[model samples]
Target: MIRSIIKNQECFSIVQGLPEPGQDHNLVWLEVHTPTVEEGTILQQRFGIETAKKNSNVVEDGQFLYMRSRLLALDDNGAPHFGGVTFALGEQLVAIICDDANFQSFDIALQRLRRKPANGQSPKAIMRSLLQIANDRADELVDQIAEELEKRAEDISEISDGYNANGMELGVPDLIETMRALNAKEELIALCIETQLSLARTVRYLSSEIDSTNEADLQGLVNELAFDVAGVKEHAYFEHQKVQYLQKSVTNILNIKQNQIVKVFTIITAVFLPPTLVGTFYGMNFAVMPELSWEHGFVYSMGLTLSAAVLPLIYIKRKGWLR
Candidate 1:
């Protein structure tokens, strides 16, 4: 579907189809969502907006600035998904194309534009507004992921203390879930980093090509955006490292638990070994075996076997291994 928003005579209005080509207007924004074959052709023929290739960097084709953006959206389960958004910026027009259900970024930019008077709105201004909105959303999502990782880090630390925040003893399943969450967050952070880097590139190119004259206000806006994007990227990288550390912590905890189990079995075997040897010696049928014919032979063998079992327990306790 294709929708057009036109700023004419200091008023913003939505038009049904693309604004009449070459029609005088202060500025126009065309949003094409999941455009069909014919719609794509019309867009290209009328506005020279064509599909960008696999590249994510902004490029200038003498007539317009073309770039592709990765739009991030969360699903019902709060998982992040990326979609493609193609932007074509011209002298007085900005076209956004995406194969998604909605153009949320455009909607938000439009709402903000409407809140203020439409005085002196230019194509560069509109493009900046859209990019700022996208950058803000990305930052917000990154912040949320950071907060979750912090919480998860605390939870894992508690588990290492032998219990969780709820005072319940930690189990393998709990660690598994924590690992899963960390992995998911890691993937999201990686995606955020990629998106931020892409935006950074776009911002630089947009500033250089579109803001060549360096209008004071616009230059400041671009600089602020670049700064914001860089900060988000750095934060994302930091959280990514945290995720890695948490993963290792979980693995180490699991390994410790397994070692404890093996230690227990080893101690049990040591405690029973002497008794097993004693029982075998007593059961031998050789007539020359000492104490074989004594009246108290059974009693002696029982006492000796019980003593053998208790000795290992005492030794283990003395070494503090039983704790």
Candidate 2:
């Protein structure tokens, strides 16, 4: 499953093969993309590359250790040039490996390289080119994330306003979920920033040893990465503000609703108090109750009850409480 791209003398070519290491071919690039150590070993055998034997055997700090080495030297401009070998004999690689999201971009670049015949490019040059392409792909991903964030912020703002207008209640769970989503998006933006920063640093390192043509291409890729990082940061800030504002709005709405409930309870109590007092007085069943002996007592009591109820209603109305 190893995919190797070799650019020799301005020509780009790709080779898909198993991993094997011992040949001294100046233009050979070996990449291993196997899921298991056993599979990687088989690939290594097929390619004749030296596999880390004991270096791949032991566990270190509760995890398997994969030993990797790269050559470092000073370039003509006195800048450090790093070119290396990578071995994934460890659990970290296994655990961290994911389905490559950028595989489509890689495939497209490889197809372009294949269509144009390689004149005489070296393997190192080809690797640099591939790295540049990968950096560009990362930038594209960042841009896509930024766009999504912007759209989400807009949608959420609209939803918040609609909820406010409808007098609908948003529960704690809904608010919490919204906050969680915002936090996740913020984390992703941070990750994109980190990724672009790493690529930019690599570009600086590669520019020293890589030829002028590739260097210019890599620099352009670096600039794009920088721009992507900046955009992501800006969008992240906007999203943060939007999320904060929405949360505050929800809090205010909940508070208003609480106050409304209290006011309703108060009005109901005030309206019923007078009727309750009259009912209590009549309920005192004394045999000598003077009102009970009167022929017009029932009408008088009814009038009294009506007056008690109506007076509060009129007063509350005048004070605007009913509104």
Candidate 3:
């Protein structure tokens, strides 16, 4: 799908013709959505873009190579920012590529550009406009991530409190899974920060290379990108702290559990010590055993066994060991 946004157009106007560099030697803005190598080739033939760029666009592995190349080119130019931005030109039109397909802000900006006086707008102005739109979308995404992190943190806090209050035990697997989730969130936050920083640098390069037609909007976008980076950093910090707290909590729970097991074993050993001693004495089978010679000796032995078992249990209870 190829969509063209003329200056001051509010919505993307899809056209059937492939995006080609216009012959007018003026800046034109277009977005191409090609999902296959064939579609990309068609777009390249129509737009007059280099074959390499077209090949880059046709990546079948879904690795986002186009975005990566844009980042790399920006970096090489000393802008080195992450995120998506593309620029192409012909004799009549210059096109800026933005990945945001459904963002309302970009639509509105495109509309306003259409209404702007055409005598003064340049390709650089169009590029800045696109950059601002991309940055605004990124800011929105960062805000959403922040909200999600807050909600997750609240959930984790509640679960932690419940465990503390009820003496609940989490198995090793559950603890490990929770830790893995925290790590994944942290990595995502870092990626967002890197991308935002790269975008900021791209904005800076655009500012230096272009004329002052849309500098205010470009600078505003840079500020917003910086703010987004800060937000991601803060979220990452919070996630790290949560992970540490969870680790400590799990360690403490395991220690308490171990102590309980040790207590049970100690009680068992204390209760059986006397019976073991009595059994050992009666098991002697020598001729010198008086209990074997008398009929009532067996009854005495049974009484002794009963007393041996019950007495230690009573002692342990009196000492509050059973509790």
Candidate 4:
């Protein structure tokens, strides 16, 4: 879908369809929402663009995606799932291509722009608003991630305390699953940071090339956007780091729990090994072995085997190995 925001004397005049040929080209913003290949072709022709921009990852007929004469750059757009925003600055117009029809960022940035009369619906202002919206959204996500991490951390503490108080046995399955979740969350935030980085780069790259009638005003907006997005990226990095710390802590706890279990089993085996040896020796003392044939030998062998087991337990207790 194509929409035209014609620059009125005071406010923007929003139209539903594409601008007609020889239409009001002076001070207009054209936004394309989820344009098809045919629409892209038409727009390319109308705007005098020789080629359209393609994502670097997109390849067809063994040809890698390269920069087009009109295309500036495309941001990373895989895990984001949401359509990526593409900016194409032409000689006579600035085109924004995106997939989502319900663009929350567009609405927010436009509202902010509307508040300042000095900043009407110019293409440069619209682009700035778009970037601002992205930064704001990213900031909100950071807060949400922080809150979630806090709650999860508390839950982990509770789980640890409970296990320690009960039987000194940690639930390996539950901890392992939670660890996996934290790892996935880390990956998601890292992707957001990457997207923000790409966005900031795109803005800075276009900072010099934006051919606006008002370059001085646009330059400041571009610089401000770069700064804001950088902050968002940093916060995202911090959140990811916290998640990593939590994951590592859980892993260490898991290792300690496993080691404790192994140590207990080792002590039990040690306490029983001597008794097992005694029993085997007495069983072999039959007719050929005089102890087994003698009347008192059976009682003697039983007492000796019991003593052997008790001696190991006493030694282990003295050494505090049983503890």
Candidate 5:
């Protein structure tokens, strides 16, 4: 859908489709979501907007592309790719171009600000407002990721302490899977931080190219956006550290548990070795073996087997290996 928001005569109004060429001078913003070639043509013919190829957000053809920050989405084969809003920032015109569904918050913000006086009435200000919404969305994603990470940390702690979510002892496989899932959350938070940083940089670049007079009124919004981006970047970094720690702790716990199992198996094998040797030695008796010929030879052989097993038990117990 193609949506345009224009600041005309000190008022912010939402228009359903493309504006006619030369009809309005204060048309500050034009948004296209999943537009086809035909829709792209409308903007190109009317406003000299460039139709970018390959759904790419990278700046091309003398048009400055501002990629909307988005969560990471892996494709069918699990490769990370961008799937969010992208706007081309240009002189006297800001195009909200997106092939992503998650870019709707900007529209909601525009609605909230529509009735408010467009006192600034500048394209740069409109651009800043849209960017602010994107940042707000980023903040919300960060908070959500943080909450999920907190819960996952608690779960990992519980498993390390030998308890499950239901207070039962958790198995090794479950713990490993839980820690692995956290990798995806960290990935998501990282994407959000990148989004925040990208938005800040794009806005700065746009601000820089404009004449000082055109950008004078947008300085405050731009500064606030930079601060927000910085704060989010710091928070994302801290959260990323927490995820790493959780992964390490979970791995250590898995290794310890595995080592404990190995120790038990090693002790079992040690204790059984002597008994098996005794049984094998008797099994190899010759036809003229005296002990096999004796009447009480079976009892003697049984006693020897018991003694062989008991000696290793005594030895291992004295060395404090039982526990």
Candidate 6:
């Protein structure tokens, strides 16, 4: 689908399809979302812009500045997905190309663009707004992931406290689920970081390409956008570090729990080993054994085996290991 936003004086109007060559509106915006074969052909024939490409970058092509960026979107389940977005910036118009899945990602930019004054409605201004929007979204996502990691840290603390205070065990399955969630958040943070960096680079390039004297205000906007997006990238990196810290904390907690369980089992085995040895000696079928001839031999052997087990327990208790 193709939609056009035309600015006439102080008002902006949305129309279907691209603006005519000699149209009334001087400033135009062509949005090609989920374009069909014929629409792509029209874009190629009219604007000479193609969407078939990979990677994110900015380049100058004759009378237009072409930029391809990877935009991040969230699914219904809040999982992050990246899609390609191509922008063709002409003197008075900008054509944005994106897939249907990422079509709504431009809503914020479009809404904010409508609120700008007539002088601020240029293609370069709109491009700056789009980058700024992406940076803002990245900031929000990073903040959210950080909050989640904080909660997960609290959960680890609770599990640790329960285990130390009351011998309550944390289930392996639960630990695994938490780790999986942290891993997913880590992936999301990485995407946010990458997207922010790309946006910042694009803004910096745009600022450099602009004729500073001709459009001083627009250049300033792009430069400020570069700084903002760079800040957001740093924020994402910090959150990524937090994610790693949480992952290590979870691992340590699980390891400690497992070691404690193994320790208890080792103590149990040690306590019972001497009794097993005593029983094995008395049960041997030796007809000439002196203990078999004595009437009280069976009782004495039982007492000795019981004493062997009790002695180990007493020694362990004194060593403070039982606590």
TM-score of each: 0.89, 0.53, 0.55, 0.75, 0.81, 0.89
lDDT of each: 0.78, 0.49, 0.52, 0.65, 0.71, 0.77
**Predicted structure with the largest lDDT when compared to the true one:** 1
All-Cα superposition RMSD per candidate: 2.6, 10.4, 8.7, 6.1, 4.4, 2.8
Ranked candidates, highest lDDT first: 1, 6, 5, 4, 3, 2
Question: Tens digits of per-residue lDDT for model 5 on 1-323?
Answer: 88777776766777888766664576777878777889778777777676554454455457554544443333445334455656677667777767664435565557656655552355666677776766666666677778888898888878878876677878698777887798887787677667766777766765565566646656766777778867877887888888888888888888988988998999888878998999998888577778877899999989988898899889999999877
By summed lDDT, the worst window of 10 consecutive residues in model 2 runs over 89-98
Off by over 4 Å in 6: 20-27, 54-56, 74-79, 99-102, 163-169, 289-296
lDDT of 3 by residue, 256-316 (tens): 5567678899888877788889999888777798887898998998889889889988998
Consecutive 10-residue window with the lowest summed lDDT within model 1: 51-60
**Number of clashes recorded per candidate:** 0, 12, 14, 0, 0, 0
Q: Which residue runs does candidate 1 get wrong by more than 4 Å?
A: 20-27, 52-56, 74-79, 117-120, 212-214, 287-293
**How much does candidate 3 score in TM-score?**
0.55
- Candidate 4 on 166-258: residue-level lDDT in tens? 456547776787798888789777777777776776666567565556577777777878888888888889899999999987888788768
For candidate 6, the lDDT comes to 0.77
What overall lDDT, based on C-alpha atoms, would model 2 receive against the true structure?
0.49
Candidate 6 local Cα displacement, residue 15, angstroms = 2.3
TM-score (C-alpha) between model 6 and the true structure: 0.89
For residues 63-135, what per-residue lDDT tens digits would candidate 2 score against the true structure?
Answer: 3222232222233442322333332222111111112212232344455446644412333334444444555
Model 6 collision count: 0
The Cα RMSD in angstroms, rounded to one decimal, for candidate 2 relative to the true structure is 10.4
